[model samples]
Target: MIGPAALTLLLGLWGVTREHSMWRDEAATWEAAHRALPELAHMLDRIDVVHGVYYLFMHGVFAVLGDSLIALRLPSVLAMAGAAAATAATARRLAGSRAGVAAGTAFALMPSTQHYAQEGRSYALVVAAVAVATLILVTLVDGRGKPGVPARRWAGYAAGMLAAALLNWFSLLALPAHAAAVFMAHRRGATRLLTRWPMAAAAVVAGALPLILASRSQAQQVAWIRPLTWSTALAPLLLLTVGLLCADLLKRLPATPPTPRALSAVSLGLPLLAFPLLALLLLSLIKPLYIDRYVLYTNLGLGLLIGAAASALVRSWRPLVTLALAAFAALLPLQLDLRTPQSRVDDVLAPAEVVARTSRPGDGVLFIPSLRRDTAEVSPGSFTALDDLALAQSPSASGTLQGKETAPQHIRRAMLGKHRILVVADVDGHPGSARDTVKRRVLVEHFTRCADTEVRGRRVQSYERGTSCTAPPLRS
Candidate 1:
């Protein structure tokens, strides 16, 4: 457990800063965490209430660490490490020490685990909480019918489940998987678990009910998610395929005499790996919420299945060593790429640097679609000297991301008044709203594009009011 945790921590710390870059999501975290407590609470009341607890926790992190990139991501690294340790402990309890070591090592090497371990988000912490809860569940099942099972174990299990669900409501998907595990254990003679598990699950539901209800009203925040397509399922399908293969391999191994409390790896691992993912996929048929990151904790089950297969081969050391090396070599490229800035959708700092270089004092700034205002909010130093022509209120004050923008006519009037305007926009120029369409019309009709440059996933343009428009309207 210690070895795997150390390895995960070292991998996370290797390129923790991602070359000093942040993407839009992390920028959101930074903006929210730096706000005053009252401002954060106000923002949550209107938007992103799903992340209210995470934001408050990060608020404390930034307050103590003074808001460096390392500070932003370190908690995730530590949480992932803790998750690896807990996963190892769970595997050891089910199988053996060899299985535990193999499981933890496999977890640290998984691309999904490595990716989220360095991110500034709640997913890793949720994974850790779920891992701990699953471990406690295993312990409770093992102790069933023994003299006086400790109540604190149930309390810890409830607390862990509550923590995971509060961090992300989708984590409730874990409950059905836990139920399946408990049922399987009950069939294996742990009959008392059938009664107690429901009590713990009910407590978790009671604790998480408020957050689930509050976040539902803010459903529009996830309105951008499109219905799941074939491409969306490809990665998860591949992972499930691998986990199934490992489970099959475990079945073919020579059966050792079962212990009194022993549960088959397939019972726990298959439910953990398959249940949450299947639930989300089925739900996505009605609404598009099946993002891979939302159920990242499912990877722990994959690790356990793979570890159990590796444990079966441990008697023949050469096969285990060869397989481990082959797996590492296969994953090396992805591990390296995860540390680069391009791994994310957009590099927020790249456009901020362009803004710093191109803007002059008193120059007006505009963000097409307005949400691009996140770039300015994240790196305010680059944008402080320029005037924001469309903003009617600040994000913190407005209790919304990107702030509130005035009416289309008011935005057009403001743009017409500025001699020079700096525009930070998306490269593809997604047709956003009627208001953004008006910004493009005014720019094309009245301003000449003097400079244009494209960064990672954004375009930075400079325009000046002139006698005739010299360049075409922004691309759409």
Candidate 2:
């Protein structure tokens, strides 16, 4: 049962492994990891991004794999696969083999997990690490085998907890919730272990210190999410926690057994499931830092809670048929949506591709107004930069008539030094400039607008200063 469930998951993941083209964030990861160590460090110092561990991990990944879309996302794929396997094991530990099978199978089909697995980001990897850590913690909490726990297992869990916290700061919250859940499950043993694991607790505090200090510095970068409102605050917490619970519960009913004990077990689990989600909801109201994927690590717990709930509902063949039809109808649209990810890469390809093909590997490719996280994601190996500029407002380059004020002089130095230049802007989306304003002002001077170039569903107007002008404007 375990082998087939894991195999089915691997096969399903293989299907979406290369579905979407490489988007911008994935590109940034490739660029960062592929560069010299010193160069990567210098860039990190400038940006307020606190993804140092991810940067370092990708540095090694890129060293071995080179920078291709498949290579960039391979780590995430492997991590999601690990999470699937771990979910199965964790379920078996918590419930029984039938429950474990259901949990693993449901995890493999989860749209959210599948979505992250296909991207080249740290979330999926973090999810896997969190799952392992959660499993270890749960084992300790549940007092599965130990009348008194082994020293080595305690040490191993201490190390794993610290590793999970460092991997993604948000999982720090998830880890504690796991400990709390374990305590609720086995109060006496968990209490004794907590007292014994003082050293482990100390290690966690020490490991989190860097993240604590870095949080102050990272304040400005994520300021966009602050000043929480009631609706915005509650929405993400509910979505991350309850949403997964509901999805998993619905997905697992087909395998449930109809018995009173099953119903009683589910009833017992509900409050245990809802508490931390409520805590997150309250915290979000105060801080407004909630994001749907931030609590992604909890999806493992959610899968189990859901599977347990479904297992409770199973009684007869009639209930099984009804549950299967309902689950299929509900998840089919979601599955289709995930199987076909919205390709921002397709949308923004016009200028990126044109620059990619035309520019030499060493040549500078500058974004007039600084690129978004997505646009900044283009491969550094493919297009070096003279200066990567983010304009304060768009429509005109700095110093242009349509622009707010003076463009930075440093930009002129970079532009003039480069042998040629390529300019790209979404006709409607470019800031400070209306569609016509961009065409009339910025596109005319440094770059001549190409006849046919469109990116990401928007018309991609391109201008070139030094190169031959054979390329046409990108079209839809």
Candidate 3:
């Protein structure tokens, strides 16, 4: 357990700062965490209530650590380390000491696990909580028919589940997976587990109900998620294929001394790996909410199965060590790539750099679609020289991730009054609101593009007022 946790921590800390760049999502976290408590609460009341718990936790982290990028991300690194340890402990109890080490090591090395471990988001914390919950469930199942099992074990499971759910509501999907494990245990004459599991599960639901209700009104926050397609299945299918192959390899080996049916790696790991993912995929068919990060704890199951298979191989073949080394060699490029700023969708600092290099004092700035304001929010020093032409209220004052903007007519007047303006927008521009249409139309008709640069997924351009209006109007 210690070995895997230590390995995970080392991997997470290797490139924790990503060249001092933050993507838009991490920028969102930074913006929210830095806000005053009342402002953060107000922002949650209006948007991102889904992340309210995580943002609140980060608010406290920043309060103590002084809001550095490392402070923003270190909690996730530590959480993932805890997850690695918990995965090891759970595998050890069900399999053996060797299997525990193998499982924890496998989990620490997985690309998905490593990716979230370094992110400044709730997903890593959610994984840690769910991993701990699984460990507790395994303990309870193992202790069935024993005289000294305490109620606190169930309480611990409930608390873990509730924490996971509050961090991200989609974590509730783990309940069905847990249900499958408990059902399998009950079928093997552990009937009392059927009753006890429901009580714990009910507690989780009741505890999470308030967040669920609050987040329902913020549904549009995820409107950007497209409906599912065949491509969506490719990643999960690949992971499932590898896991099943591992399971098959274990099956081919001489069976170790019989364990409880429920404790078998196949029985527990298969359901844990498949159920939540399948449930989410199916749910996405109704409403497109299936993102792999939401169910990252499934990696725990995959790690357990792989570890068991690796343990069997080590016992049966001397070349197993060579194979492990070769596997790491093959994954080296991807591991390194995941540490770079380009690994993320967009680097908020890149555009901010462009703005800082090109703009002068009193130059106006515009964020097409408005949310690109995150770049400025993330690196305010770079933007301090320019005026935000459209902003009517600051993000904190407006209780928004992006500040509220002035009226469309007022925005157009503000733009026209400036001699030079810097525009920060998406590479493929969004169809924006009437206000955005006004900003675009005025820029295209009245301003000449003096310079333009694309960095990562964002575009930053400098515009100067032209002598004559000749360009066609921009589409909304």
Q: Which structure among the candidates has the greatest lDDT?
A: 1
Candidate 2 colliding pairs, count: 27
TM-score, structure 3 vs. true: 0.95
Clashing pairs in 1: none
Residue 358 of model 3 has an lDDT of: 74
Per-residue lDDT of candidate 3, residues 80-176 (tens digit)? 9999999999888777777787888889889998898889999999999999999999999888724578989999999999999999988898898
Could you tell me how far off, in angstroms, the CA of residue 151 lies in candidate 2 after the best superposition? 1.8
Off by over 4 Å in 3: 145-147, 257-262, 316-320, 467-476
For candidate 2, what is the TM-score? 0.74
| Candidate 1 lDDT score at position 208 | 94
Query: Whose TM-score is greatest here?
Result: 1
Supply candidate 1's per-residue lDDT for 196. 88
Higher-TM-score candidate of 1 and 3: 1
- Let me know the TM-score candidate 1 reaches against the reference structure: 0.96
Stretches > 4 Å off in candidate 1: 145-147, 256-260, 316-322, 467-476
Sort order, TM-score high to low = 1, 3, 2
Q: Name every residue pair that clashes in candidate 3.
A: none
